[model samples]
Target: MDTADAIIVGAGHNGLVAANLLADAGWDVLVLEATPHAGGAVRSGHVTAPGYLSDLFSAFYPLGYASPVIKRLGLGEHGLSWRHAPDVLCHLLPDGRSVTMNRDIEVTAASVEEFAPGDGERWKNAYRDWQDVATPMLDVITSPFPPVRAGLGLAARLRVSGGLRLARRLLLSARELGSELFRGEGAKLLLAGNALHTDLSPEEAGGAVYGWLLAMLGQQAGWPVPVGGAQRLTDALVSRLVSRGGRIVYGVRAERVLVARGRAMGVRSAGGTDWRARRAVLADVPAPSLYLDLVGARHLPPRLVEDLAHFRWDGSTIKIDWALSGPVPWKNPAVGRAGTVHLGADLNGLTRYAAELACGELPTEPFLLAGQMTTADPSRSPDGTESLWAYSHLPFRTAWDAEPVARQAERMEDVLERAAPGFRQLVVARHVAGPADLEREDPSLVGGTVGGGSQAAFQQLFLRPIPGLGRADTPVDRLFLAGSSAHPGGGVHGAPGANAARAAIARDRALTGDLYASAIRAAHRAVYADR
Candidate 1:
C-alpha cells in the first residue's frame, strides 16, 4: 500500500494545486489521475492535425490571469509563459461591426463610443468601479466562503463605490445591467457576451456578476494563453509540484474513498489497490462523484445524499476544433486581432438563443464563443495557418444523436462563417466533441457541463455544491472537496484546490490544529444538519 500525508483523487489543475501547496508545506503529497495526462479540461493537443494544436476543453485564461490564487503559484518559473493577442476579445455582430476589448481602457472606451456617443465615458466609469473593487471583489470570490477579511475590505470600499447600487448591479441580469449601464448595443453586447462565457444567459439573474467581472478583467488583463498550448499551464503546475516533492500516479481511477470512523483514511483505486492518506484525502472530482460514487451514498448523511440528487450542472457544450489552412477571412479586420470572439447577431439574437436552449430546443442560430489560437500564440500552428475552435451550449441532459450533433457543429461553423466569410473553406481538418465525448475524457465534466456545476444564484457562494460553509471541508472528516463544485465554482482559477489545501494545512497545524478541526467539524455539522 502506498502512503502519503495527503491523497488527491485527480491530477486536474485543482488537484495539482492542492498537491503543490501541501508539498510546499513539507507534506508528502500524492495525486491520482484517471487519465494518462495531467490536465483535465485545461488540456491541449494536436487533435485536428499533426502541426495544428488545439485546446481540447477550455482555451483562454482570463480568470487564471486575474486570479491572485493562481498568481501566488508563480507558475512562470515552471516553463509557463503567457501570450496574448493584439486585442483581448471581439464581439462581432451580424452586420460585421465588431466591439473589441483592449487592455488599454481608452481603446476599449473608444470602441464602445463608436456605437453611442458618451458611452466611452460610461465605459471608463464602469472600469473605474472595477478598479476600485477588483482586488477585494476577487478576494471575496476566491477565498473560502464568508471571506471574512476580504468581505470587510469590499464593504469598506463599496461604501464609496455605491454600496447598495453596486450590489444591485451585481445581482442584475446581464441584459438588465447592460441596459441600465450602457445606452448602446456595443457595450451591452460586450457585457452580455462576456456573461455567456459562463452557463448564464443574457436574461438570467445574477448574470451581470460574471459579465462585469470577465469584461473588466479583459480590460485589466488581456485574455492570455500558454505560449505553446493550454497544456503548458498544467505542465507548470505539475512541474512546480514535482519540484516540491509531490508525486502523481496517472491512469489510476480512484474507486472509493476509505473512511474509518467518519474520517477519511485512504483511497482505493479501481484495481483494488489501497493508497493510504495519513492526514486527508481531497477529491478533485464533481460533488456527486465524490459524495455518492467514491465515498458511497451509504456513508453520507441522508440529507447530503438527498441534496446531491438535486445538484444542478451547467449547460452541456459541443465544441468543434479546426486546423485552418489560413487565417479566418473576417469581414472586419479588427475581429482577426482578438484571441476570443463572441458570435451573435445582437442582444436580441442572444436572448433568442438562450431562450431556445432554456426551452430544450436546438437553436437554429447558436451563439458561439470561439478562439483563434494561432493568433493568440503563434506556436499553436504553422506560420500561415490558424488553429481555431468554437463552442456552443445545449440544455443540460438534452437528448441527441450523432446526426444532430454534427448539425450543431455545422451551425457553429455557420455562425463563424457569418463573421468570417469562407471560414469553413479554411478548415484543413476538423474534430468535434459532443457532451459524451467530453465526459468520457474527464468524468468530472459531467455531461460536458464545463463549469463543474451550475453557477445559478441559488447554487453560488455558501450554497455551492449544496448548502454548506462553502469551505472545502466535507461532512466526513479529513476529506475535502477540492474542485469547481466548491465555492467560486468553475474557472481555471485554483481557489477550490487552494482552499482545500489551506483547510488541510490549518487542520494539521500544531498549535491550532485541534481548534481548527473542531470548528470545521461544528460548521459542517450545522450546515449538514438541515440539508
Candidate 2:
C-alpha cells in the first residue's frame, strides 16, 4: 500500500490545480489519472496532419486568462504563454455582413454601429456596466456560493436599485435581454450565439449572464490560445506541481474509493493497488460516478441516491477538426482575422437551431462555434496554413452511427462553406468526433456534455451537482468533489478544485482539535439536512 497526505482521483486541469495548491501547503499529494496523459479535455495533438496541432477538446481561453486562480498560480512563469488573433470573434450573417468583437471596446462597439445607428453607444454603456461590476462579479461567480463578501461589495457598488436591476437581468433569458437592450440584430445575435456556448438555448433563463459575461471578457481580454498548443497549459501545470513535490501517475484507473467508518480512507486502483490518503480524497469525476459508482449506493442515503438518479446532464456534442491548406476564404475577408466565428444568420436562425436540438433532431442549419487555431497561435500550424476546429451541441443521447457521423461532418462543412465561399476546398484532412467518440476519449465529458452538467437556473449555485451548501464538501467525510460538476460549473478556470482544497484544509485543521470538529460537523449537518 502506498500512502500520501491527499490523493486526487484525476489529473485534469482542475485536479492538477488542487494537487499544486495542496502540495505547496507542505502536504504530500498524489494524482492518479486513468488516461495515459495529464490533461483531460485540455490536451492538444496533431490529429489531422503533421505540422498541424489541433486541440483535442477545449481550445479558447478567455475564462482562463481572466481567472484569478491562474494568476495566483503564476502559470506563465512555468512557461504558459497566450496568443491572440487580431479580432476576438466574428458572427457571419446570411447577407454576408458580419459583427466582429475586438479587444478594444471602441472597435467592438463600432462593429455593432454598422448594423444599428445608435447601437454603438448602447454597446459601450453595457461594457461600462461590465467594468463597474467586473471584479466583484468575477469574485461572486468563482468563489463559493452565497459569496457574502463579494455579493455585499457588488451591491454597495451598484446601490440598492441598481443591484436589483442587475439581479433581474441575470434572471432573464438571452432572447429577453437582447430584445430589451438592443435595437438591432447584430448585438442580439452576438449575445444569443455566445449563450449557445453552453447547452442553454436563447430562451433559457439564466442564459443571458453567460452571454454577457463571456462577451465582456472577450472585449477586455481577447480570446486567447496557448502559444504552442493547448498541451502547453497542461505541461506548465504539471511542471509546477512536480516542482512543488507532487507526483502524478498516468494509466491508472481508480476502481473504488475506500471508506471506513463513513470517512474516505483512500482509493483502490483497478490494478489491485491501494493508495492510502491520511488526510483527504478529492474526486474529479462526474457527480453520478462519484456518488453512485465509486462510492457505492450502499454508502449513500436513500434520498441522496434518488436525487442522483434524477441528475440532469447537458446536451451531447459533435466536433470536427481540419487541417486546412489555406485561410478560410470568407466572402467578407475581415472574418479571417478572428480567432473564433459564430455561424448563424441571426437571432431567429439561432432560435430555430436551438429548437431543433431540443426536439432531438439534427439541425439542418446548425450553428457553429468555430476556432481558427493558427490565427490565434501561428505556432499551431505551418505558415500560410490553418488549423481549424468547430463544435455544435446535439440532443442528449443522440445515436451516432458511422454513416450518420460522416454525414453530420459533411453537413458542418457545408454550413461553413455557405459562410466562407470555399471552406471545403481548403480542407487537407479532417478529424471528426461524435458524442460516443468524445465520451470514449474522456469519461468526464459524459454524453459529450462539456459544461459538466447543465448550467440552467435550476441547476446552478447551491443546487449544482445536487442541492446543499454550494461548497465542494460531499456527504462522506474527508471526500471532496473537485470537478466542474461542483459549483461554478464548467470552464478551464480551476476555481472548483481550489475551493475543494480550501474545504479540505479547513476540515483538516478543524479535526486537529475535537471541539472544532464538533462545531464544523454540526454546522454542516444543519446546512445539508434533507438537501
Candidate 3:
C-alpha cells in the first residue's frame, strides 16, 4: 500500500491547490485523478480544429485573477501567464446595441451613459463603492465561513459605504439592484446576464451578489485567460506541486474512503489499491459524492445522510465550441472588443429563460454566456481566426440525447447569429457537449452543474453542503471537503482548497494538534446533534 501525509482525491484545480499547499508545508502529498489529465474542468484541447484551442469547461477566469489564494501560489513563476482582451465584456441587446464593460472606469461609464442620461455617474459610483470594499469583501469571501477578522474589516467599510442599506442591496435580486441603481435597460442586462453565469436567474434573491461581484472583479482585474491554453494554468499548478515533491497518479479513481472508528485512514482506489494517509484525506469531488459514494451512509451522521437526500444540484449545462474562419462579425463592432459576451435580448428575455428552466421546460430561446478565446489570448488559434465557445444552463433533468442536443446547439447558434450575422459561415468546426458529455468528462460537474452545487442562498455559508460549521472538516475525522461544494462555492478561485489546507495544517500542528482536533470534533457534534 502506498502512503502519504495527505491524500487528495481528484486532481482538479482545487485538489491540486490543496496538494501544493500541503507539500509546501513539508507534508508528503499524493493526488489521485480519475482522468488521464489533471485539469478537471479547467482543461483546454483542440477539439474544434487542430489549430484551435477550446477550453473544455470553464474559461475566462476573472475570479482566479482576483483571488489572493491563487495569487499567493506564485503560479506565474511556474509558467502561468495571463492574457486579457482589450475590453472586458459585452452584452448585446435586442436592438443590436452593445453595452460594453472596459477596465477603464471612464470608458465603462461612458458606455453605460449611452442608454440612460445619468447612468454614467451611477456606474462610476458603483465602481467607487466596489473599490472601497473590494479588499475586505474578497478577504471575507475567500476565507473560511464566519470569517471573523475579515468580516469586521468589511463591516467597518460597509458602514462608511452604505451600512445595513448596502447589505440589503447585496441581497437583492439582480433585477432589483439594476432597476434601483441604473434607470437603463443596458446596465440591467449587463448585471442580469452576469448573474446567469451561475445557475441563477435575474429575479433570484441574492443574484445581485454574484452579478455585482463578477462585474466589479472584471473592472478591477479584467477577465483573463491563460496565454497558451487553459491547460497552462493546470500545468503551472502541477509544476509547483511536483517541484515541492508532491506526487500525482493519473487514471486512479478513489472509490471508497477508508474510515476507522470515525476517522479517515486513507482511500481505496477502484482497482482495489489501498493508499494510506498519515494525516488527512481531502476530497475535491462534489459533496454528495464524498459523503455518500466515498464514505458511505453508515459512516455519516443520520442528519447528514438525510441532508444529502435533499441536496439540490444546480441546472444542467450545454456548451458549444467553434473554430471560426475569422473573428465574429458582430453587427455592432464594439461587441468584438470584448473577450466575453452575454446574449439575452433584455431583462425580460433573461426572466423568460429562467422561468422556463424553473418549469422544467427546455427554453426555445436560451441566454448564453460565451467566450472568444482567441480574442482573449491570440495564441489560441491561427491569426485572424477565433476559438469561441458558449454555454447555457437548463433544467437539471433535461434529456441530452444526441439529436435533441444537436437541435439545441442549433438554437444556440441561432442566438449567436442574431448577435453576429453569418456566424454559421465563420464556423470552421464545432463541438457540442450536453449534460451527459460534460458529466462524462468531469464527474465533479454532476448533472452538468459547473458551480459544484446550487448557489442559492439556502445552500451557501453555514448551510453549505448541509448545515455544518462551514469549514472543510467533515463528520468523519481527518477528512475535508476541499472542493467547490464547500463554502464560497465554485469558480476558478481556489478558496475552498486553500481553506481546507489551512484547516488540516492547523489541526496537525505539533503543539496544538490534539486541542484543535478536539474543538473541531465538538463543533461537528453540536451541528449534527439532531436526527
Candidate 4:
C-alpha cells in the first residue's frame, strides 16, 4: 500500500479542506504545497510595511460568511473571526455622488430610492421573489454534489413553479435582468458591476445569475473580513487539517501525477521524490498545467486533451495594497465605511473600460474594486492607520513591459481621485502585485487569472473545461480536477476540492478494488461520441 490513504497536490485552501474532511473520517492524508506557505489566494503578509499586514490575494470574503462548509469546520474556534464594515458595498459615482447598501432590506431599499423615486418598491418586489427561490437554490448549489440522488432532488425542485421562474432568469444576461427590474441608471450600474465580479461582461450569457446571487447575499450578509487577516483563516484551516492527522509539507511542487494501470496512484515531486497514495490523488493546480504540462496526454483521453486545449481562463488582475497614514477619507464619506467600494459612474464608463481592456489598452481612467480592508479589522495595522487594497481586472495574458504596474497605478489614481480627491496624500507606503508577481507567487494563477479557467457561460457548470462532465471526475478513472476549474467553479469557496474528495470517496466505495481501467474505457467512449 502507499504511504497514506490520500495524497493532495497543492496545499491551497480547497485542498486543505478536502484533506481535513478525509483525515477527520480516519484517512491518512499528506498535503504538498508548491509554495513555502499553506494559503494560495488566501495568503496574507506584510508586503507594504513591516507592521502592516497586506492580503496577497483574496481579502474580503462574503462567501466565507455564507458557506456552510466553513461553519461545519468550526473555523471560529480555530481562529476565524469576522469583522464587517458599516455598509456592504459602496458605488462611488463619477457625478460626485455615492450609493451605499446596508444588510437590512428596507435600509438598502431606501438607499436606492435616492436615485429612483419608487424603485425602492420594485427592488423589494424583486428581492421578495428572489428570496422565495434563492434559499432552496443556495441549499443545493453550495452543498457538495450528491450522486444521482442529489441530481434528481434538484430536478424535482426545478419542476416546481418558483424554481422554474428563477431558472429562466439564469439563462438571461445580468444587463437584461437589471434593465427589466429598475428604471434608474444607478441601480443598473450596481447590478452590472456586481455581475462582473468574476470579470464576465454584463452582456455575456449566464452573467445575470451571479449578479442576482451576490445582490441577494449582500442583502443577507454584508461582505466580511477575517479578524486577524485572511492568513488567520488559512491558519485555522491548516490547523484543523493537521488536527485530523493530515500532514502538509511546504515548498514541494508536484512535477507529475503517477499513473499505473490507467489509474492515478500518486505524484512525483519536482524535487525528485516519489510519493504514493492508497486511495486518491487530488490536485489544486490549474487545468492546463495539471493536464498538459505535468501529466501529459499519454495518460489522458484524447477528447479531454482537446478540452484542456480549449479551456479559457478569466482574465488577469492587478492587486495593490497600501499602508495608509489614515483612512481613505473619501470626498463622499459614505463609501469610506464600506468594506468593498466599486468605482464606476454609469454604463458608458464600464463599457469604455471593457473596450479599452479588450483592445490591449489599459484604460486612462480605470475602474477599480477598492477595499478598506483594515478598517474592518483593527489588528491589520496600527490603531490610527487603515490598510487598503484593490484590484482591477484586465485582459488575460496581455504581454507588457517590466514596469507595466507603474502605468496601471497611474490609471488607478484616476479612479481614486474621482471619488476620493487627493488620494495620493493618504498613502504612507504602497505595494503592487501585477500579473508577473501573481505568476511568481503561484504558476496556477496563470497570469493572475485567479478564478482558474474562465467563469464564462461555455466554461461553467457541466460545460466547464469540457462538456458532459463537470463534477471533478476526469476521463482518467481515479484522476480528478480539484481546482476551481472544476464544477461549481472558482472563487474562494473550496467547493471544487470538496467535490473532488466526495467523487473519490464514491468511486472508491463502489467498484471494489481499482475501477480505473473500466472507468477510463467507458469515459473514452462517452467523450468521443457526440452528446
Candidate 5:
C-alpha cells in the first residue's frame, strides 16, 4: 500500500495544477495517470515524419494563456514560452473573402468593416462593452460557483439594469446575437464559427456567451501556442509539480475509489494496488467516470444517479493532422498569417452543420477549426513546411470504425481543399483521429466529447455535472472532482482543479472551514433532500 496526504487521479494539466498547489502548501501528493505520459489532451507528438511536431489533440491555448491559475503558477518561469501569430484567427468566407481577428481591437474592428461599413464601429462598441466587464466576467467563470466576490464586483460595475442586459445577452444564441449586432456575413461568421468551437450550434441558447467570450479573449490575448509545442506547456506544469515535491505515477489505472464510512480514503488501481490518502482524493477524470464508474452509483443519492442517466455529452469529433510540404496556399494570402482558421463555413453554413449534427446525420459540409503550427511557432516544423491540424464535430454516438473515420477525414480534406486550392498537394503525410481513437487516447474525452460534457445552458453553472452547489466538493466527503466536468467547465484553464484544491484545503484547515463545510452540507441536503 502506498500512502500520501492526498491522492490525485489523472495527470492531465488540471490535475498537475492541483497537485502543484497542494504540494506547495506542504501536503504530500501522489498523481496516478493511466497513460504513460501526462498532459491528457494537451499533448504534442510526431505522428507523421521526423522533425514535425504535431499537437495530438488540443493545440492553441487562448484560454490557457488567459487562465488565472496559469498566471498565478507563472508557467513562463518554469520554461513555458508562448508564440503568437500575426493574427489571432481567420474565418475564410465561402465567397473568397475573409475576416482576421488581430490582437489589437482597432485592427480587428477594421477587418469587420470590410464586409459592412459601419459594422466596424459596432464591433468596436461590442468589444468595449466586453472590456468594461471582462475582468469580473472572467472572475465569475473561473471562480468557484456562487462567485460572491466576482458577483459583487460585477454588480458594482454594471449596476442593476446593466446586469440584467448582460444576462439577456448571455441567453441569446450566437446567431441571434450576430443578427442583432451586425448586418454582414464577416462579423456573423466570426462569432458563429467561434461558437461552434464547443458542441453548441448557432441557434442554441447560451451559445452567444461562448462566441463573445472567445472573440474578446482573442483580442485581449492573441490565441498563443507554447514555444515548442503543446507538450511544452505540460512539461512546464509537470516540472513545477515535481519542484514542489509532488510525485506522478504513470500507467496506473484507478479502477475504484476506496471509501470507508461514507468518506473517501484513497483509490485502488486495477492491479489491486491501494494508494491511501490521509486527507483527500481529487479526481481529474470526467464527471461520469468519477461518480458513476469509479465511485459507483451505490454511494450516490438515488436522484443524483438518475440525473447522471440524463447527463448530456457534447458531440464527438474527427481530427486530421498533416505534415505539409509548404504553408497552406490560402487563396486569401492573409489567411496564412493566422494561427487558427475556420474553414468551409459561413454563418448560415455553420447553422446547417449544427442542424445536421442535431439530426444525427453526417454533415455534407463540415466546419473545420484548423491550426497552422508553423505560423504560430516556426520551430514546430522544418523551415517553409507547415504543421497543420484540423478537427470537425461529428454526430454524437456516430459509428467511428476505421472506414467511417477515414471517410470523414477525407471529407475534411475536401473542405480544406475547397478553401485553399492546393491544400491536398501540400500534404506530405497525414494523421487522422476519430472519436474512438480520441477516447482511447484520453478517457476523459468520452465518445470524443470535449469540454468535459456539453456546455449547453442546461448543463452550465451550478447545474453542471449533476446539480447541487457549483463547487468542487463531491457528494462524498474528502473527495473532489477537479476535472473539466466541474464548474467553469472545460478549456485548458485549471480552474476546476484549482477550485477543488482550494475547497479541500479550506476543509482541512479549522475554524472558517467548519462553517464552510456546514454550509456546503446544508446546501447539499437541500438540493438532494427528496432523494
Candidate 6:
C-alpha cells in the first residue's frame, strides 16, 4: 500500500502549496523540511529582543500580490494580512536627493521632478504606456515563462494602446530603459535600484524589466507586508495542508529520491529514514540539490547532466540586521515612510558594482537594498524601535568573513547617515550574515543567488537552467523540480510548486503504487547497500 499519495521535500512555500493542492484533491501527502522550520527564506522570527519581529530573508512581496495561486488558495483567511506603504520605495542618491514612487501617478511624477522639472510628466507617460501592457506583461512574467504558447497568447491578448512598447522594453538594458523613460537622475536611479533587486546591475539586459514592473506593480498593489510578519504567509500555507490531513516533518532533509525501473518512489531523508510514497515524489528544493545530490547521476539524461554542470547562480549577498531604538529618521521626511529604500552613490557606482562582480572583484561602493519594516508597520518592532534588515549583491563566489561585513555595512550606514544623520546612535543591536551563512541556512540559496539563477537573457524564458525542461519535470518519470529554478523564477509565488504537484499527480494515476515503491527500494539498495 502507498504510505502517502505524494512525498514532498523541503517545506518552503512552494512545497507547502504543492502539498496542500495534492491533499485537497483527496490524495495523502507528506512534506519534509531540512531546517527546523518550514518557509525556507520566507521565515520570520524575533532575532532581536522580545516583540521585535524581523523577517529573516525576504521582506517585500510584490510577487506575492501578483501570484494567482495565493489568491486561489485563499491564504488570507488563515493568518496572512497585508499592509501597504503609501510610498513604495525610494532611492537615496549620494547628494541627499531622493526619488520616490507612490500610487498617485502625478504625485510620484512630482517626486521625479526633483532631478529635472519636466521629467515628472514624462514619467507619467511611461506609467500610462505600462498600464496598456500590464495584463499581458504580467501574463508573460508569471506564467511558466517562455511558454511560447503563453507568449503567443499574450501577444494576442493585448489590444490596449501602445502595447508594442513592452516588446521594446525587452530590448533595453536597465540603464537604457531608465534614461529613455525619464530625464531626472533621481528617477533614473529609482528604476536602476528597482532592477538591481534581481541581483543584476543596471547595465545588464532584461534587468530593467523588473524596475518598471516592480514600480508599476507597487503603484497598483502597494509594497505590502503581512501584518504580523512574513511567517504569517508561511503559517497560512502550512495550516491549509494540515486542515486537509497532510503531514509535515520539520528538521528532516531528503538526501535522495529513491528510484527504480526508470520511475520515482519517494524519498530517503538525510537522517536515513525512508518515507515511501507509492504514488509520486515532488521536490521543492533547488535544481542542483534535487537533480545531482537527491536524484543521483545514473537516472539523469546525459544532456541534462551537461545543463546542470553549466547552470549559473546569480551572485552572493551580504545581509545585515539591526535592532534600532527608533525609526530610521530620513532627513527628507517624505522618504522616511517608504517600505523599501535603496542606497547608491551614483549611476557609475552601480555600474562599477556590477562590473566588478562580472570581473570577479568586489566593488568598493556596494549597491544596497534596505528594508525599513518599522517605518511601514510599526508593530513589527517595539513601540519606539525599528526591526530592520538589508542585503546587497557581492562578487559571485566571494568568501566574505567579518571584514567585508564591516566594510559593506559601514558604507550602508554611511548612506543612511548621510540621509539621516546620527542614525547610527539609535542602533541597539546588529547581526551580519555573509554569503556562506545564507547558503548554509538554505542550500537552495546556492552561492546567494537570490533570483534562482541569473535572470540574464541567456538564462531566462525557455532557456532557463536549460531549454525544454521548465515544467518542473525531469527525465525521471515520478520525480519533479518544484523550486524557483523551474519557472516564473523566484519571489514568493508557489506556482512552480503547484505546477510540479499537478504533473506528479497525473503520473501517479498512470503508474501503480507498487511500481513506484519497488523503484525506491531498488534505487536505495543499489546506492546504499555497500555500507
TM-score of each: 0.97, 0.97, 0.98, 0.95, 0.98, 0.91
lDDT of each: 0.90, 0.88, 0.89, 0.78, 0.90, 0.78
User: Residue 198 in model 2: shift from native, Å?
Assistant: 0.4
Show the colliding residue pairs in model 6.
Answer: 260-519
Question: lDDT tens digits, residues 212-313, model 6?
Answer: 778888767778888888889999999888988999988877787888887787788776788888777888777878888988878876566666778878
Q: What are the runs in model 3 whose C-alpha is more than 4 Å off?
A: 510-512
Q: Provide the clash count, candidate 5.
A: 0
Clash numbers, per candidate: 0, 0, 0, 0, 0, 1
Per-residue lDDT value at 47 in model 6: 75
Model 4 misplaced stretches (Cα beyond 4 Å): 143-159, 511-521, 529-531
1-531 in candidate 3: lDDT tens per residue? 999999999999999989989998999999999989998999988898889988999988999988989999999999999989999999987778889999998899888899999998998898888998899989999999899999999888777557687789878999999999899887777788888888888999989999999998998888989989889999999999999999999999999999998889999999799999999999999999999899998997777888788888899999999999999999999989899998755789899999999998788998888998889999999999999999988789634667767777889999999888899999899999999999899989887789998898888899997788888989887899999999999899999999899888877874866677777778877777765
Candidate 2's displacement at residue 234, Å, is 0.7
Candidate 4, 199-310: lDDT as tens digits? 6777777888888888777877878888888899899999888777789888888898888877788889886888888888888888788788668888776767776668
True-vs-predicted CA distance for residue 383, candidate 6, Å: 2.1
**Candidate RMSDs in order:** 1.5, 1.6, 1.4, 2.2, 1.4, 4.9
Tens digits of lDDT, candidate 1, 1-531: 999999999988899888999998999999999999998999988888989999999999988988888899999999999999999999999888889899999999999999999999999999988999899999998899879999899999877557788888989999999999899899999999989888888999999999999999999998999898999999999999998889999899999999988789999999799999999999999998999899997677777888888989899999999999999999999988899988866899998998998898788999889999999999999999999998999988834578878889888887887777898888889999998999889888888789989898989988999987778988888899999999989999999999999988887774876666677778767766753
Judging by TM-score, tell me the better candidate of 2 and 5: 5
Residue 509's lDDT within candidate 1 is: 77
* lDDT minimum window of 10 residues, candidate 5: 513-522
lDDT of 4: 0.78
TM-score of 2: 0.97
Model 6 lDDT, full chain set: 0.78
